[model samples]
Target: MDKIEFLTEKAAQIRRDLLKMIVNAGTGHTAGSLSNTDIMTVLFYEVMDIKVDDPDWDDRDRFILSKGHSVESYYTILADKGYFDKEELNTFCQYKSRLIGHPNNKVPGVEMNTGALGHGLAIAAGMAKAAKMSKKNYKVYTLMGDGELAEGSVWEAALAASHFKLDNLVGIIDRNNLQITDNTEKVMGLEPLAEKWKSFGWEIIEVDGHNYQELINAFTKSSEIKGRPTLILANTIKGKGVSFMENKAEWHHGLPSEEELAQALEELSSKGEVI
Candidate 1:
């Protein structure tokens, strides 16, 4: 298959895998995870330069899941990429399992422990700055939830990234509009979000988060930008691919029942051409 087709099918399967993993674990950030699956897929499978067998190779590009609660998709991608045994996903969130509710550094491919929100940007910026200092060409990518933008630290990090001219740093916002309790705007407004980032000296690129082609192009474009960090404002649908759960805030951290799981699988499978 071609690149776009390959990415689409890969993302579909990832969604399925994360769903099963979450249901088996009996807990997860469902909506956000689903929402960001496509973005994660593009980065891991195509955009980023990574080594599955040597996850910590010095020159490998870095990925930081700042919105760590939505780690189902992230973990699924890592397992699929051979960073760990895929079977380990079945133990997610279990007592003593390395795969807990959020991104954990103990995991083979995880760059840093995150989930506190607003801290990922700073950490990623530091990595980018370090790369520049060491004269390494590797890039640093960070994914953040739109809701997380409310934290003042995110802006502070944005300012730092710009001031240092960390062109190697790429920040992506999962602009799904919903958080755990309500709409992102209701919880905290982020309108003109692109302008805010621009004012902080970031080059903003907005795209359909679920569209493979747009995502690929945006990531590619980020690499070509110079003297400033890039921010990809990815507009996405929370609980995407599952009809009943789409855009519903309740599913932000909901565990699917067996029947719901079955229905979701059927829906995903119904897209015969994709998965």
Candidate 2:
């Protein structure tokens, strides 16, 4: 099989793994996790330079999930990449389990305790700036939800990323229009979003979040940009894989019934195999 096909299959497996983890745990941010599956899959499997056995290795690429509630897929990808045992997924959300509703440093591959939203970009910019100060080549990547863009801190970090000229930092906004309470535009308008970032002195790249090719091309281009940070505005469906869940805001914190889980599994399966 070709590289795209392999990545596609791996993404499907990631979706299945996260779904089962959420369904079994009886709670999760399903829609956002599903939406960012393809993006996260590409980063972990293709783009990021990471070592599963040596997660803390110097010079490794760093990734922060600013929208940390969508962490089901994040944890699953970490375990699948062998940062931690896959069996730990079964204990997710249980009392005293490290895999709580949001991501924390307790997990092997997680960089910071996130979930409050809008803080990831600031932290990532700090890391990237430190890399420049220490003369290191590692790049820092952070993923944020579009709804989180309303946070004042996000723009402050954006300004800092540009002012410092941290070319090694890449920030991605998951442009899924729906948030927990309402549509993103309804809650807060972010149109001319790309222009806003460009005005802040960052290079802007727009892409279909689910298209592996577009995502790959965007990351490649980010590396070539100099004297500025890169911002990838990834347009995405809130619940991409499942028909019933697609674009529906109600699923933001919704739990699936066993029947719903079975249906979703079938939809995500390939050749009758989820994994």
Candidate 3:
């Protein structure tokens, strides 16, 4: 019942919620959602200074899911945190449910609507700049997929974030390596990723994304940095908690069959309960 163990259990439950929501809805980005679950868990549950009861608090921290296809993880965490009713999760991806395939501003805790990829960092940069202008103490964080880095817009935003010295901005790359089409290297090479961010004037910190302690340490260190944005290269596994789906590109966007859902739930149950 310590911090690490608690976060671990919360991650497992979120993954379970994601799998069920996707399977029931008959659609979702399975691998990316699962891969980003731990990072989202730590952010919403521990790292970000958020108030579930008052999501629009003027000084509350802002988070953008730039790799918006991973909305399942974000939504699951929001619901669990009381940003909205958990039952609303069942309406995901339905004809008119607010919880669609990607993050939507209509959702209580969502900062902005995103799904286009490569745009989140830029938006986050603007938010960070606005915070600085208003002299707000809140931070702006955005999570992007490794594949999304291929877009020139991402680099453009990176340059802007550095030039402005937005130390309150944090960018996290979900370095799971597997995108929808293939491995990131095969689709679009982004090797020496840390060096690339460093060159962009970011304080780069690489860590095992699934490890709560490592994530907490990285986020904590990010806050102490000055005069530069921080980029966390979160090395993670695609379809992280599910054995058959792990590291598989096909699971990037797919629906799990009944048997698959059962197996995934059983695997999550073995990890321990969310206390």
> Whose TM-score is greatest here?
3
lDDT of each: 0.94, 0.93, 0.94
Model 3, backbone clash pairs (residues 3+ apart or across chains), number: 0
Error of 3 at 49 (Å): 0.7
Question: Which parts of model 3 are misplaced by more than 4 Å?
Answer: none
Kindly list the per-residue Cα lDDT of model 1 for residues 133-173, writing each as its tens digit: 99999999999999999999999999999999999999999
Write one digit per residue (lDDT tens) for candidate 2, span 115-155: 89899999999999999999999999999999999999999
Candidate 3 lDDT (Cα, 0 to 1): 0.94
Model 2 regions more than 4 Å off: 271-275
Worst 10 residues of 2 by lDDT: 266-275
Q: Which tens-of-lDDT digit does each residue in 68-98 have in candidate 3?
A: 9999999988999898999999999999899
lDDT of 2: 0.93
